[model samples]
Structures are given as C-alpha cells and as structure tokens.
Target: MATADPRLRSRAQQQQPAPVAPPPPPPPPAETTPAMGLDGSGDAPESSGTSSDDSFKLKFCTVCASNQNRSMEAHLQLATAQLPTISFGTGSLVRLPGPTINQPNVYNFNSTTYEAIHKELADQNTQLYTQNGLLNMIGRNLNIKKYPERFQDWMPGKPRLDHKGDQGYHGTESGVVDVIFTCEERCFDAVLEDLHNKGGRMNRPVHVLNVDIKDNHEEARVGGQAILDLALSLNNAASEERKARGETGWDRGSGGARQGFDEKVPEIVAAWQERWPTLPALWSLAWF
Candidate 1:
C-alpha cells in the first residue's frame, strides 16, 4: 500500500505458505502380513485356492533297472526317513541279471519274494552272488523292510501295476508322483521317452531326474543318500515357492506350480550332481 519496491513485493509473495506434500503415502499400509492359519502357521488363510487338510508330504518314486538295488535302496532310505515313496523298474518285467551275461532271473516284482530269490540264488551258486556281494546286499534289503513286496513294477505311462491295485503309496492317485529319481542314465532316458510318448494323457505333472549312479551295493548306498538329500532340497524349495505365491498348499492342478517346479529342476539337479563330480554319471532333468 505504501508503494513498496517491486523486489520487496516479490519477496512477500515468495514467503507465502507452501502446499503440504501429500502425507507421504500413509506408509504403505504397514506392509500387511501374509494370511495365517488358526494354528499360527504363516500359511495363507483358508480359501478355495487353499486347503486346511492339505498334505505337505511329497510323494516320490525311485526308478532303476529292476527296482531291486538302486531304487529299492533309495526307497528304503526314504521310508526310513518316513517319507512317502514308491519304487519302480524301467524294465517291462522285473529281471535281475546274474553275473554272467544272458543269465537274468526274471520275476514279477509284485509277487516274487526276495527271500525265495535269495535262497534260489544261494542254492544255484552261493559263491556267485556271495563273492560278488549281491547276496549281502539282498540280505540287507530284506532286513531294511518287511518284505520284497515293497518293490512295485512301474513304467512311465501306466499306473503302477502292483498286486494291491492302482493305489500307489502315500495315497497317490493313478500312481502319479511329484518326482521320480532314476539311478542310471539309461533308465533316465527311458523315463523321458515314456513321458514324451504318453505324458499328454497324464492328469498331473511329474518331474523326472537322473543321478547316474553305478548299480552296486556301495554305489546304491551313496546314491540313496544323494537321493534323500535331493528330495529334501526340492521339498524345501517347493515350500518356499508356495509361500511366495501366497499358496497355502501344493496345488497339483495348478499349471503355474508345475511350471515353477520345472523351471527350478535343472538348477537343482546340477547342484546335486556337482557334489559327486568324480562319479561317472550323466545327470539330466525333464518334466511333463
């Protein structure tokens, strides 16, 4: 009003109060905690996408030539650890080849008794298997489980043809397994081929991995331990994935879950195989 200088008037205008800065976004709602179960587990809340009665236990299938040595060993190890598992043979029929070529003794995995096989082998030539350490391994297998009935015949496409019918271990429907660990490269190839040829018909996803171990007692022992380690690693990884996806349990029907598993499988198999670098083995992975 007193005809103040133009500079002074500009200063007065600049001194007026500035607008507030939008209250800093309300601190992002405190990053809401993930839904939880009544038992206090950090699982997603009950919903159609989640199940409270879900079984967290993973079902495994071990495949080797005859399901007698390598697969059986891993099967027993899994059983001892109280994991749900089943064993299979890549062969159309269970046939244990003897030390001599063309001397395989064929038997049905579902019906033949290990004891009878052992006795027969012993009677034929105790020294044949005894000296080669097969008898000892067979004996150990018998002691590990109640009977040879623990072994079941399985191919990739068909449901496990067991005497007990199609009910696979751990209540798996149609003999579907979350993962199948093969002991040798050939068996691994067989599984992949079977899956390729018939996987489209499968209702659930299956992961096939090869560890490529020698088919012997000591090797079987080593392979079994390795398989157990891999199984645990996979289970842990899968759990973390479910949590990240906000899933309360494994959704077998979810293609996303299966894809996630398939994505991580190569890395997991490579890491596990790296531990036994000196072993003459071919490690590979495939899923369908």
Candidate 2:
C-alpha cells in the first residue's frame, strides 16, 4: 500500500481517471504489466523519489513548417532538460513574414544560419520584425541551434555539423532520433511521405508524431511544455522497461526496451492527451 492512505487524500489529489480505452492502439501498442507494475498477487513495484528523466535520454527530432517557432521552441525545451534532440523544417524553403504579407522573406534551408537570418532581419527593419515577433522567434532559434534543417535533406546515420560550441542539446551525439514530432498536420504528412520515399535505408525504426500547434509564440510555449512532459513520460516508461529487461541501451538486435516502449506509446499519449485536449496529437511508426 502507498505510505499515505488513499482514503485520506481529497478527490482532486487522487490519480486522474484512467483514459478511455486508448484510440484503437495506433498500431497495437501493448498493455503493459499494469499501472501499478504489480504482479497477479498485488505487490506494487518498488518506489523511488528520484526522477528517471535524466537517467536515460531519448534522441528526439522536432519538425515544423519552417523550423522557426514551434519546432525550435520544442527543441529548446528538450535541450533545457538536457535531452538529446535535433530539429528540422519540412518546407521546401524557409519562409518568414516580411513587412508586407506578399513579400515574405525566404532563405535556403541548408545555407542560411539562424544567426544570419536574425541579423539580416534586425538590420532590414528591426521595429517591423520585432513587432511581428519574427526577430523574437529567430532570436530564440539562434540561441538553440545554428540553422534550419530540412527533413527532406536529412541523411540517416550522419551526425549533425556545428553541434559543438552551440547552446543546443549536447547529450549523446547521434544523427538518428528515436522520435520525430511535427508541429502541424501538413508537416506530419510531409514527414510521413518523405520517410516512405526514403524507404528505411538505415533499417532503424522510428516513431513519427504530430501535435497541432498554431504558429504563434504563446501556443508554442504551451505546446513546448507539453512536448517536454510527453518526452519525460516516454523516457520514464522506457527506463522502467529497461530495468525490467536488464537492457542498457535502446537497441540490441531484436531485444530491448524499444519494443515495450513502442507498445505502450498509445496508452502514454492517450493519457497525455487527456490533459491537453485542445492540442490534438497523432502517432505512427516509421523507419529511418
């Protein structure tokens, strides 16, 4: 039994109601041993006050239309937690709103750096960009990474360049990511289609999820926090499975926490969705 009596706690303090049978298991996510981690005889799993967030970090990738606001916000959040993360844009070219709506500023996703974009925009018309929040958005992007990366141009198993000496996530260095989150449905579609076109050259499985976030600062902040929470929840689940299976890393040739973690994704996301109802989420398994 828990140290504190369940009856004494108020209803608000009680655990939230279990989610309604998770949306058809988005691809047969497994029903783990049970929420308690208890056996048939009803013995609860061992307890620990320490968090598992930093114990094992999942390699993540965040994607958005132009990788300016939402994705970068999520990148910042994951990096802030010291999680291994990379980010990208799904657009053909990076686009930012210019002084006039028709004359949007466009840049080469591969050649332009966030710093360069920030400086140019600041010099062109500081007040306009600042008032429109473009400068502020790119300013944050500059702090998180060097430039906007195109998901279409990403080559699996190839490490990131300019990773060192940046205020980015310097956790485990690997070009591959375990999960890919897109900030919009169209971007998610682009990612899925792109992955289909690539056809798994790396032979590594990855999860692609979409969380619809409006292109705005306030919404991005809320979505970023939600993404971080989801990341932590996922890491916690994977860490538990790792402990149960005596595994050390994510992949081990057809055996490891990866399988269990994949199986539980539906339930985990479902629980997370219950909290952030306004932000709709989508999930699917793909390869890199």
Candidate 3:
C-alpha cells in the first residue's frame, strides 16, 4: 500500500514520520564466473611479463618440433599483430628433408643460422630444395629470425638476443612469456615436460596451449591465422581481467587476483575452438 505524501500528512503524523519502504533489495552482486587455477600453490611468478605488463599483450612463445613450419608461421603472425613473441624447436637438431627418404640434412639448432642453411641447401641443389619447399621455408624464416632455437636450451629469464646482437623482434627483453602455443601435441608435451623438470621457480602462472596444425607450409599458414585469432581473444580477455582486478598485480593477500585471467582461459579457448574447428586445441596452466 502506498503511504500518504508528506505534503498531505497531519501535523502529528508528519512529526512521527511515515513508514519507509525498505530500499529495493540491493541489486544482486554481479555474476562472477571463476575459472580454476592450473595449480593451487597460491604463489605468483617472479618474472616481469608472466603476470602483467605495460601493454595489452600477454607475451607469446610458439613452439614446434622443428621450429621451421608451424611455429615460425605463428610467430610471424603474432609479431605481425605487434605482440611480443618467440619461437623454438623441440627436436635435438634442426632437420630438413634431403635427397632421399632415409637421409635428412641436419644442423645444430642453436648454432645453425637460416642464411647458412639456405646457402648450403641452395648449393646442394637449388631446384630440388625449391621443389621440396625447403628453400621457400628458409627464406621466410630468415625474415623472422636468425636461426632455429631449441626449446631445451632456452635459458629462462634471459633477454632475447638474436645472432646479430640486436634485441629480439618487438623486444622480448623481459625474458618471460605469459603464454606458450605449441603447434602440435608432441611439442606441447615437450614444453610441459621441460617446464615440469625445471620446476615452478617463477611462481607465476603461464598458460601453455596447443593448436594441432600439420607440418606443412600451407597448413602452417592457415594455423598461423587461427593462432592469431586465439591470441587476440586471449589478449582482449587479459586486458579486461586486469581491469577487473584493478591494480592488484597478480598477488593479492589471498591470491584472489589470479582468477582474473585463469578463470577466463577455458571459456575463451572453447569459444575460439568453435570458430576454428579444424584446429583442435589443448590447454594447460603451467609456470615459467
């Protein structure tokens, strides 16, 4: 029932006051859908870029068995988006197809430069390597970086320096990444296993994800686009995540800030999978 207006209230009733309707029930608190953390240690990483950075990007590292086909393609796409990125190979050495099915040209992953491989392959047989697409792959790699780097040998927290002594493309000087995208399952396993062996020393959480793309130039290109799309989705979420958490940086007294990003990861990937059904993905929460 409505109460009488104050203007019409009798003198005594006005002095007594009218009954006040309870304030409409406080609007229900916002729906906060929390994503699970990869681990329950409740510790944040010590590295500079793993958790938060000055820019919108969560730095990216792309990995593949050879680092020639899929990883490089993804790296190119990520860097093209102005995202800080690096690429690595999981194999013992860089291998390229040679004259026969049984024979493969091999080079030290860390020491062999793309120019050296391209020149040597060209010297061996330009027409054959061209027909095989090795030359074209090498040329593409040359524009991206100096050589194939082995993930096993990557020194965590060390600034990225190319063979030419310049800082890595877009300055990976932070020596840390917020996410890793492996081109296939084996490479994803290698990355996780390597991280496991290294232990979670950084205390920061890094998302390791896999997009299974075949090892071919054309497939790599298609996968690169897909990877870029995923990166963008994750990047935008990260920005919102940071905003929601305010400036808490990844470490609140009770570790509440981390949920900002971790909670959104699975949802984001699932949505991305819908758009790119051809490229199946696997995700894990790992550390630096």
What RMSD, rounded to one decimal, does every model reach?
Answer: 27.3, 17.2, 25.5
Compute the lDDT for candidate 2.
0.69
Candidate 2 lDDT, 46-108, residue by residue in tens: 222223344866678999988888898787666666667888998889988987789999999
lDDT of each: 0.56, 0.69, 0.69
Name the candidate that leads on lDDT: 2
Q: Determine which window of 10 residues in candidate 3 has minimal summed lDDT.
A: 33-42
Query: Which candidate model has the greater TM-score, 1 or 2?
Result: 2
> Is 2 or 3 the stronger prediction by lDDT?
2
In model 3, what is the error at residue 7, expressed in angstroms?
A: 72
Q: Residue 189 in model 1: shift from native, Å?
A: 1.6
On the 0 to 100 scale, the lDDT of residue 89 in model 1 is 73
Displacement of the residue 24 alpha carbon in candidate 3, Å:
76
Colliding pairs, model 2: 30-263
> Which residue pairs collide in model 1, if any?
none
Candidate 3: which stretches are off by over 4 Å? 1-55, 161-168, 250-257
Error of 3 at 193 (Å): 0.5
Tens-place lDDT digits, model 3, residues 49-138? 222335656678899988888888777667656677888999988888988888899999988888788788777777677667777677
